[model samples]
Target: MAEGTRRELFTILETSSADADTVPDGGETPVNLSMDVRWFEIPFREPEEDEEQDEEDGERENGCRSAGGAEDTAGGRCDIILVTGNGIKHEEEHPEEERYYSVSYNCSDDSDIDFSDMEEEEHASCFGLDGDSEEEEDCASPHFWGEPDQVISIEPFSVLSGPQHSLGSDADTRDYFRLLFPDSLFEHMVEQTNSYALYRQRRSGKSDPHWHPTDLREMKAYMGLNILMGVNQLPDVDMYWASDIFIGNAGFKKTMTARRFEKLTQNLHLCDRESEPVRGERGYDGLYKIRALLDVTENTMWDSYTPKRCLTIGQGAVAAKGRFCPTQYMPSKPLKKGLRVWMLCDSRSGYCHRARIYVGRASEDATVTALAYRVVTSLVRGLEGKHHHLFMDSFFTSVPLMQRLLRDGLYACGPTEPGRRGYPEVLRPCNVGKLSPGEFYQCQRGNLVATVTRDSKVVSCLSSNSAPGLVGIGPDQEQQGEGDDNWTDTPEEGGVSFGVPRPLPLLLYQENMRGVDLCDQLRDCYPVGRPCKKWWRYFLWFYVNICIVNAYVILRESRGSVPPGGCNGKHFTQRHFRVRLAQQLIGDYQGARGMERAARKRHADSPIEYGHRLERMSERSRRCRNCTNKGLRHESVFGCKICNVHLCRGGCFSEFHK
Candidate 1:
């Protein structure tokens, strides 16, 4: 059976090979090979006859279509057993045929799947700072800032006025004024002195701060107005253009006196020392009728301010060579002033010191110093137990002066001038009711012996009792008993304690230590002191600039920055509005500098002229020869450069400036 199958399959292959000329199909062959053909039994899945299957798969001669039978392809799973059958051609109906095998395959394109269109969602979200994740429940939010080390690095900046300065309107600067001053700051200065002067000038009958004077009488008031505005920002400010102030250069000599001061209320008056001429009282120190002018303000047209105390001092002007007739009481007045009214010369105090030896105007240093001493003089009444400061250098450090301050119930502290005497050489130990000796040693003020001989005796002396057996080398380096410098030798037959004759320092002790060290140490014990560093002045300048800038900001509006509603609401200007912020700015910078000096110089020549006027007081005014020639001859120029006008620089220039 196997031999027959093999012979049949081999015959089909041999038939094809023997006839190489058969072109059975239209397809052409590219290359041809004629060779022997042998058919191995290849199993077919459709059960084709073995010979027919071998014929379908027989080798082509020149161009034959059949290689493996078309139906001979495997149907199901087929596994061919190579039992060394005579040929591969096989027919099988049975699943287990010896020459048959089973094979199966899925009809797929066998193509590779491309992931190019895989459609992955785009990446999102940053790397997490929010701690809201469930796994991060214990974690705190990460910080991006607020770390300590990042803040303090110095950044260099080129600072200057920016372009916004030009854009700054009167409205803007006015708001700045409100931001700076507020009512509280003004009230603070008001509690000190009651000398406030404000002038009103109306354009279209509407008053503005920029108002200037137009008349001779009002012009004098304007001068006073200008004076106050000038010094409002000084080291120790007392006067202001539109508020009450103390009348002084803020000198150390100022003493506080609480008396009912006369309200001028639009009335002008001279001091009692400057009364009407006594036919020969003019031109003398008692002759230049010092007066006060009051401008009445109608708050509700019902409130009237009356002059409370006015005392006549000396009759007749110094121009007429007048002498003060002594009096102890002041004149009482209930009189209110009308517009342009003038009160006769009257003094605020019964006894007065004449400026006979001094030249025209008061000096800043001398005046401020005098004011300070005056404060010390009145300490018992004005200061009580409260601390008071008396800032001073060594120039005023006299031992008697310090002792005098202590006697007045005020503490004393200050730097000492060099080469002076009466300082501590006594390191007397503390005893009795005084500090313990060890405690006294702990005091760092000084360690010299004999600072106060017999510390207990000194303590008793401080309690208003005179101490015995205590003496020292005086300021003159003489014995303690040697001093007319302590008190005047005007012997009154009455035995009264003027004061103990304490030694006065001729010159203060120059600092052996630093000025600041001395000042700090002294401050711990007393009220007066001085800074000792070379850079102290620089420190002072720093403080001064802050003061100046603050002053400039507050007072900037006083220079007419406040318009009715205050340049009212950004852009509107009303009755009280002024448009020139730059004018105010520039003026604030220059800010009436040297105005006092200039004013002083302006009046320096007046004293000589005043002397001449006083000498001729009895003569004639020529125009008002019979009308009491005491009337002021307005002699100066109070001019407004903008308006091109002038008014009296003296006398009653009050109403005119308004």
Candidate 2:
């Protein structure tokens, strides 16, 4: 062999031998004889002329010639020999098998080894040494973590198609609210309520004589009273009808009697109990009692308004103290023990577009990612091909989910937990502390980008819709900076300052992920919810609050301009809208007073002894009660002195008395 190549081989073997000796006892001993010594030649004895000719021919056929030709082999085949620390010898007859010798060394322990002496071909040949070696090569390749600083393409958002309905200038608060809760739903409620009352009466075999079947008008009035109760809260339900000068709400007494309102509340039903499936039946539903109401409300929300480009997916809790199978306990949440609901809402207006009640986990082993995927997919079912960007939290963000959303033409951005699957190993929590405040590291896989940034603390985010780069603080943060003297452009010790670099995905998540929270805020402002023994009642009130918030948002948007007086303006705020809506819903609907009150009024009037006497009415004529009951609007100027009420002077007075 050549002297130069021989010296290099000897140097590598000596170094490997020294390294092997330093290995601790009972520890892994790896001898790295990494070199370009493929074939070697050593002269053991002289050969005959016939043998020399035969060796040259064999070398040519085998393509294993030594560096200086067949003369270096001393007219014989060359063989490579390697000796281990334990005096074991490994001899290779073929030069092609030399790579196998390198494979025997533990590649994991070669972190400090320099590969500069090895050719590109030799480095490439070491792929089979260890799986991690191949992974290291991949990590060094360009675009291995996807193209650096890649920007996601943004699609122009537009409402392509939805229910077409327009409100004119003459529209009232009731008109706007009916867009979300129409008259048909009220009729369905009335039907189910009357049926349930009849069923109860039959089962008891004794019907109360005071019970009267409710119609659509009375049911609407009943709903109106419920809404008004939210605005004028009292300690007890009957207090709204109290006749005391200090605490009485006369409007409640004017609309419906306390007894009748209580009766309607007791019999209120959204679905027929007789048709409910048995507990162990195949088609049993946990929410069957309020299923119709939920369906109608959800369908109406989708049909009423189209959401904007940015959306949010989150969970909400409806407080309840009833026996429910799907109640979850979340000590961190405000409504710690209650029913859970998943919601998808608009970021700009906080309008709920879709919702799903959490019944329970589908199975015991169901993963968190799987449940989040199902919820996001189910809520955004009809919104495909619309290019809506969704923001969520770590419970819902995962690498596979982001990829799936990208494939569906949807986009998502959110913070992710470090331990979540497919998170970049280079951006781990341990490395986060090494980054300076406002500094970030990102890795991309196709459209999905996983980013870790150091702010107040280490925050990791995964996104399919945002670019991977630093951005300045947002406008809201700038506003906050004005009040706080500590806010500045300069960085602090292990913390971020105002107007510093922030990850784009983190910014987007912060800006657009509060839709559900905003919805909760609006619902909590004048909460219509109250504690109830029935679990479905809590859900019913929750959906009602959602509908009211959504309706108010729609009304504000449809108006195109805010009134001058802020919340005090007519139909400006949710409070004004709800009050006006309740008034219109209760228009002209009256309930019968109790028999005691009627007899007391009769006894008080009988002592006057002014029976059947006619008296002239004052200003404008009122509608005759007898005529209005017959669907006629006959005005009356004459009044009965005995009754002290307006009536026609003829048979109408005698008919009202009868």
Candidate 3:
């Protein structure tokens, strides 16, 4: 090894490491080990005359590239290096015999070895120092490296367990509802609400006359009214008890007074306000007001139903127009400004199994990808090792995250951004733009595969659960083909077709990624949300609506099947289920009427004399007010014309005017 000269070496080995101890003594014959011989070319060549002139002028090239640029017409001389293993005898008399070379121990200095002139196929020879004989060829390739005998094996997902409950056709709406809002939860709400009211009274030195300590039954009735309001909505809460004949609902008036409902709504509390940490404190929580409710709801959901194999992780927005620190502004979401919540839901049923409120960033130094990783890991905590296949979006998919999930025995697939770290450079969006529609380029490292496919747009995806290849038309595509002739398997020359081939991972993602969105859709229908100054109230209503949706889902699953028409020959939609649930919650409980109802009645009675007259009614009959007051079960086909009130005919009508 001279200062400026390159030496080309060829190495050979007579025996494998395992067979080294059985080498025979030098006497009889030397083993011809040509098949076991390994070659390595390390060049140590002399520089040209121009280089010597440049060296004299203080402009010398210091790297192997400069030395390799010189011509080598006459083949560089080769030197054979020998490796002698433990218990193996070497004889100097057989100098012409093929020798063993272990480049790992023999290459003492590599500063003088120039590799720039080596051919592409000879790159494998450079990694001889890696010392892995079996994987020697695989190490030569730039994109992949591992044991040569390694195989890709993905574990198949199997359902080891599911929802464990005895709920069957015997379960009613109340039973289903109770699963999510247990009696214990109602009692807890009662205790917290009372304590909060007492704390407020003590701080202000004035007691609220309307605020009486609420009981479990009253809480149930209050929640029932909220659910009813979502079903039969009105602009104002008092309108439910309005004296207007067209607008008022008698059922609401009988269930509870409008004043009592208002009182409960104003004083609702999930936790004691006094126990909350002050703002700017180290242990302060932005969602403290709703923390207890969120925790209980999430735990109940997890216990009520076990999610199926396919699960989706995504973010949903709970609309809140208020001054809150944790509120986020996502312009892309339908609800532009609101609180963001991360949810893990069952893909098939859209039932939410877990939810977490996004209260800003966890710390100042956390990056977006780091926050996403933490959210996913936290949501899927108990689900690990269950062989569940999780689907997510670009926000949560990354090479490292997918690899980490595969290690945990969880399968994951999602659309990934091309620029993410560790993504294969060969399958970058720019590099794969030339692929035809339905065609793709993929690179696999172990079980994780990164694919770039051409669809309407260039899409890049990473998946640990699905193999990399194009799949035939799926069920959804087949349905589309039925409606449009252009969706046929073979398209006409110039016709635009929707039947393009899709990568297996993309197909799975398309089919299962709507779980969170579906949950959001269900929650949005007939929403119980109302305008409130307190931000936590919005979150309260959000969870309440979600509970109803989840309860309905469980009821459907438990029942297994609905009769031909429905339960009792009526189409049982969610609206019907909610109506029944509210009725059960109200039950036979009765509360005293507020003073405002009595005054409104007195006022109405005063206006009765304006132009009172009995008038015949058409269409449906109503319960006669005069007969009901007198404890008679009489129907009315007539009412007072001026007062627009329904009453029994003859004696009953005349007596109402008096």
Candidate 4:
């Protein structure tokens, strides 16, 4: 080798030695193999006098030549070296028989190489640098690394699609939704309403005597009467007496004292458990307890006068403000932090058939369309297939919702958003509002129709069942003269032309959509509800008041149909009805226990145990003044020394005390 090429090779070997020492073992002892194949190459070359000169010329042309650097050695090139850590001298005495040292580089086609049996190490050996020396080798020459194994395959094409059968998919969702809803919704609503009373009865049966109310049923009646009689100005205790025992603002001596009234009302029990702080048990902590009463009352009202045809879905607000209050929008004022109730009522009698409190959206996936559908379906559950017409406001009106109702055999009509799917595009507000007043345009698609009328401004309504029939001249049209620009001049008949000019759909909506409003007006007459920390209490009172209204309506209808000398001979106002009801309820269990005077006397005369006892009075034994007041002078044998009064066992005992 030339002097400069020899120095360059030595310098490369020295740098490789330094790099090998710094390379980490990765916490493992790696097998070290050191081989030099240059000696084999040199030994096989023919010894020629001018061979050294040829090598020197080739080295000068390639700049710095290495085993893998020259393009002539690019194919199948690898330096073949074998240096075992176990010291063993190779028997190289027979060159042709020495298999380990006989290097072979196969440059032929490798179409039949078996790559399956090739280990990762064997593959690495084929392509990796074969020796520590940085020199290019010509594997295409007779002595070099073998060719590598290749792999090739063609894959067939496949199409990807959505699930054919999956849970909660659109195809499976309807049945799942049915499971979430009540099967017999009418019975479910009625059962919820009556659950409280049934629970109270069960609880009272198991409760201790101390937990019993003075009169459970009577106390409920008295509470109802107090609401109708009005006691907003009176103290809580005074309310009890003013509603039942007391007459006007009479002196205390004429009626039950305020202290006695307080004592009676305090013992009222609707549930068995004691107050929470006293017993350390949850006691009526949620709306569950009172909700039953409200629900039952509404159900009873519905049963008494079921709405047969038209019903309206409308919202009613309960004014409440607190962190716990559900946020509900109010069109009349600023955002009201309160609860809303969607009520369905009879169009003619204003009877509330069904109502649901807006607890929140049904779920995270709930949208405006979904909520409206849920409310409408829940309220009109049993009425499906009856072809009952339901009227609603814009908040709940939508094309899909109406289509679903029609599919269920119901007719729905209300003002809906123009952007709602299935709403006719030609009936857009701008397109239809170009007509003069009383001039209307309508578009019908299948069973659904959209009507646009330009009255004060523009009004659009969608109806699944109603049609835009012939327009008739209304009273307003009559007020406008024949020369009015909006009305076309038609031939007058007998100096007058009068025909209904109002759109039929608008007329029907005006008539049928007032059910909810009428129900609200009736409830407003005497709200009987008091401010409560718990929002549901207001609904409880509201349901009770409406029940009374429904009863009044039934009574009026029945009386109006009565012939001369009918059963309902006397007419009574709602207030009179409430007064009579209170009297009857209290009278049923009037004399269950003793009054204040009897208890006081018993305390004062403690040693006189036999002061009062049950004894029958004869016709002439003694004239009891209590009996004389009733036009009966029979002697009242039942007399108490403590109270120092005479009384008949049958009526006077309960009458005087209650």
Give the top-scoring candidate (TM-score): 3
lDDT score, candidate 4, position 475: 31
lDDT of 2 by residue, 1-658 (tens): 3445333332231124345445432222111122211111111122234434544554544333221232132222323222222321223233332111010111111122221222111111111133354335443343345323233454445554323368776777777678888888899989998999999899899996656899998888888888888888887886776645466676777677676777787888899988899988999987899888887888889889876677899888887777778889977568788889999988767899988999877775279888888888888888777777889888788876776676566878898888766676555665333444655556665456777777678798888665433233322243343435442333432222334346557767776878898898888777674576777888888888888888888777767566323335443677887887888889998676545245453332221111234567667788787888789888877766546678776567656766
Which scores greater on TM-score, model 2 or model 4?
A: 2
Candidate-wise lDDT, in order: 0.23, 0.63, 0.63, 0.45
lDDT-better candidate, 1 vs 3: 3
Clashing pairs in 3: 5-44, 6-43, 6-44, 6-45, 7-43, 7-44, 12-100, 12-101, 13-100, 83-100
Better of 2 and 4 by lDDT: 2
What TM-score does candidate 1 reach?
Answer: 0.20
Local accuracy of candidate 3 as per-residue lDDT tens digits, 340-454 = 9999998878898898888778775267778888889999988777667889989899876775676566878899888877776555654433545655555555556666777
TM-score of each: 0.20, 0.66, 0.68, 0.50
Q: Sort every candidate by lDDT, greatest first.
A: 3, 2, 4, 1
Q: Write the per-residue lDDT of candidate 4 for residues 175-225, one digit (tens) a residue.
A: 221222212322343344244434555766763232223334434434534
**Poorly placed runs, candidate 4 (over 4 Å):** 1-212, 230-287, 318-324, 327-329, 332-338, 430-435, 477-501, 561-572, 588-658
Q: Point out the worst 10-residue segment of candidate 3 by lDDT.
A: 69-78
lDDT of 4: 0.45
